[model samples]
Target: MTREQFIKRIAPIAVQLRAEGSPIFPSVRIAQSILETGGTINPWNNLVGYKVGGGAITPYWQGKSVRKLTWEVYDGTRQDRVPADFRAYDSIEDGYRDQDLLFEKDRYRRVREAENPEEQADMLYMSGYATDPNYAVKLKMLMASYGLGRYDEEAVQLRKEWQERLQQLEQRKQALQARLQTLRQALAMTEIPEWAKEAVERAVQSRLIDTPLNGSYDFYRLLTILKRRGVI
Candidate 1:
């Protein structure tokens, strides 16, 4: 996805996270997340430096990571292998979600122990969580450059606006959907063969059941809940 799409998708989650006392993540920190996750420029679409596998198990993932410990460049380069338990995701949004979950994990107690982004970045860098010596500095720089220092204030104002806009959008979308559904039901009520009605109903249900493509849900639940919900 494009950078704008990525930002729009993760912004709410980031704001909610900070609002819930998850450390005020600056816009820069979030952008840095994009960078680490293979931003729009890269194809990896990894939001966090989640490596495959190395004996560490993400509380959210029932299966082991793809690699034990893989090499990732910490100095703004994807080259050079570094020993880290990198997390992986199928989509950019899932990566961000995983990062949030990872931070909440007890293993990252030091990061949770930090009170601010600077300290958190430092702790994450120094504690072997990130290998780059300048990781903290870069994160701070990103924060400043993007004017993310005012994350909390911005989040509040934007959240209010977002709520208003979301309400309006939802209302509009619901109206449109209702009209479409009504039209479908009317059409179904009209002269139509049973086979054709079944086909249309199946098609609509199929669309409704489009499964959430992201990872994180346990495999069994992922199957059961999504399927039960009529999602793929």
Candidate 2:
């Protein structure tokens, strides 16, 4: 299949990963696959930059390698190729599954705190996967360029819900704060002993207040009344 065809085929796999609660950044990984494999329909379906033979042999890519014009390694330079652990799969879903498994390994314990594709890719590096220094930067750039930052609608919706809840909490906190302030002012003015007028005055000036016991703003109005009378 063509590159676009491959992306279309694997997009649903990415979606499924999201549905299954896998926080892997599929978009970033997919972009890296594109860059590494040259496209989806290449001779070898090596998606995750896996060299051929699958071991610590030489960097010899027996299968198809992506065309790199400048470097011999990029241009099928199989001389220094090392045989690494390349998980073979029958389908794109299998490839994606391996990717998810790679992330789930104990080495990737930091995946949960990874907030972006770059961080996710970096974790992969930290876990001793790819040794490329620019792995995270390239993956991040590709994700941004292709708008692949949002791998699935489910993740996007989850983020949206969290943001909405945060907004609501902030609004409630503000409302509660205002109500508490009003209540504090009201309490300071209520049932003045006539001897504590100076104390009330000091309290009002200091603004060191607390929540109101009552739901009404009568306490604040009472304080205003006291102020007018010069009692506090």
Candidate 3:
């Protein structure tokens, strides 16, 4: 796929993940994805060349992996055609989530703690995330050329708005739940008033009401009046 298409597909998801508390910036994510995957999604959904390591399992990764020839640099020597087992995921989002989990490690703490995309990119290199000496430069170049940093701003605003919306919905939910609880308690009927006990019993026998005991005062009064009016 074209780079634009790749960005279009991945950027929104990366933005959402960032908004939802993934420490990785959208700019760094998109840049790394493009750099690693060449703007194309793999069938296994391993877009960032995340290799298998330490037998870690996340909700997003179920221990699936794929073998691929990868490049590596060591002590000023470059090595290519190195077959490696890269982690595979059920979906692109899953792949991103799994990669974000890797950033939780102590070794990658600096990468997560980086203040911005450029700093994060530099941290990724400094922390030995990639073997290439120019890994940070390449990432920064991609970010600059693609304007990926805009997503970070977008995510910040989106997260704020989402939190507000979530709070409103939560308040509404709590109100509804409390109302439901009150209604449930009301339905349980603590006592049937003496004035309406006979009417309530008759109504229950006639199958007009299921239980006569503990009917609310208003409910019992209504039933008695209705019975007197031959409406029950």
2 or 3, which is superior by lDDT? 3
After the best TM-score superposition of candidate 3, give how far the Cα of residue 64 lies from its true spot, in angstroms.
3.0
Segments of candidate 1 deviating more than 4 angstroms: 1-9, 20-29, 41-45, 54-86, 90-93, 105-107, 155-232
Best by lDDT: 3
Tens digit of lDDT per residue, candidate 2, span 14-59? Answer: 7666656676766766776776666654444557655333332222
Candidate 3 all-Cα RMSD: 4.4
Clashes of each: 15, 11, 3
lDDT of 3 by residue, 1-232 (tens): 7899999999999999999999899999999999998899999998888899886788999999999998899898999999999998889999999888888989998998898789999999998889999999999999999999899999999999999999999999999999998887767668666788778877987899886776665788889998899876
Q: What is candidate 1's local distance difference test score?
A: 0.58
- Model 2's number of clashes is 11
Error of 1 at 224 (Å): 60
Q: Give the backbone clash total of model 1.
A: 15
1 versus 3: better lDDT goes to: 3
Across 113-212, the per-residue lDDT of candidate 1 in tens digits comes to 8766777777777666565677778877766665665665766677677779989999999999999997666544434343344433443466843433
Highest TM-score scorer: 3
